[model samples]
Target: MAGRNMNVYFQEETYSKIKNLVAKREISRFINEAVEEKLKQRQQQQKEELRKKLIVGYQSRIKNKKLQKILLTYGEMSWEDLSAKLEEQEKNDDNCKK
Candidate 1:
């Protein structure tokens, strides 16, 4: 495959190990594969983190929609009925907060 040639450096100890273990002509290939593997790992981690954030955001929206429904129910109640309903809703809010 066609590739760019650029200067690269490694610590003396690491370079020694790489030269000892890898064929001299293949050191560039070894470093390239290592970089590719690390890139894949980071990309996968970012995708997973974004997925988790999306799920949390969706759950929050659903909770807000339910609260809106509850508010509508209260809006139709008589003042005398509202106190009991408000107290019930407060208890539910406390439970959900935990």
Candidate 2:
């Protein structure tokens, strides 16, 4: 509380809502608690989004490996190309692990 000073402008209806919520209690404390809870919710949402992206990427990788196997069996690609691709994939995996 002592470390922050900020201004926020709200519509009349929104201001009224906030006042109504704290009409029978300490307004400052109520607002502080509400803001804290909202920040926590935002942080949690960001974490969940990152987790979902990682899961999708992992699934897509498995699909790519399957396709590569099919192509290799049909002799549609060269060993040199396959080896290079494997090296690139390894690099990406190492980056993700870090």
Candidate 3:
């Protein structure tokens, strides 16, 4: 944990809930869980942005004709080689797939 600081903000009804959590000796645990979840969501968003940037960067660098040529060329390879190629392709393809 580095460069972390706290500032308090209150919503209309959540303070009592937080206070109850504190009285139960679970406030820190709850806060940590909330932080962990927020971090996870932020990380996921950053990952998605990076992926989008890479896709745009790659597409800007290569033409569709070139990509199609590469795929078609792989399609002509030996079955074992093609299977390996397809597996690799499938892994990368899965990243963009929801």
Off by over 4 Å in 3: 1-7, 20-23, 64-98
Q: What is the TM-score of each candidate against the true structure?
A: 0.64, 0.56, 0.50
Off by over 4 Å in 2: 23-25, 67-98
Query: What's the alpha carbon RMSD for model 1?
Result: 9.0
- Give the lowest summed-lDDT range of ten residues in model 1: 66-75
lDDT tens string, model 1, 26-95? 9999999998999999999999999999999999988799788988887888898998877899999999
Runs with alpha carbons beyond 4 Å of true place in candidate 1: 67-98
Question: Could you tell me the lDDT of residue 6 within candidate 2?
Answer: 64
Clashing residue pairs found in predicted model 1: none
- What is candidate 2's lDDT per residue for 1-98, written digit by digit as tens? 47475677879998898887767567667768889999999999999999999999999988799787987775865888788888999999999999
> Please, what are the lDDT tens digits per residue for candidate 3 over residues 34-76?
9899999999999999999999988876767787888789778
How does residue 34 of candidate 3 score in lDDT? 91
Better of 2 and 3 by lDDT: 2
Error of 3 at 71 (Å): 25
* Deviation in Å, model 2, residue 82 alpha carbon: 10
Return the TM-score for candidate 3, rounded to 2 decimals: 0.50
The lDDT of model 3 is: 0.82
Q: Rank the candidates by TM-score, best first.
A: 1, 2, 3
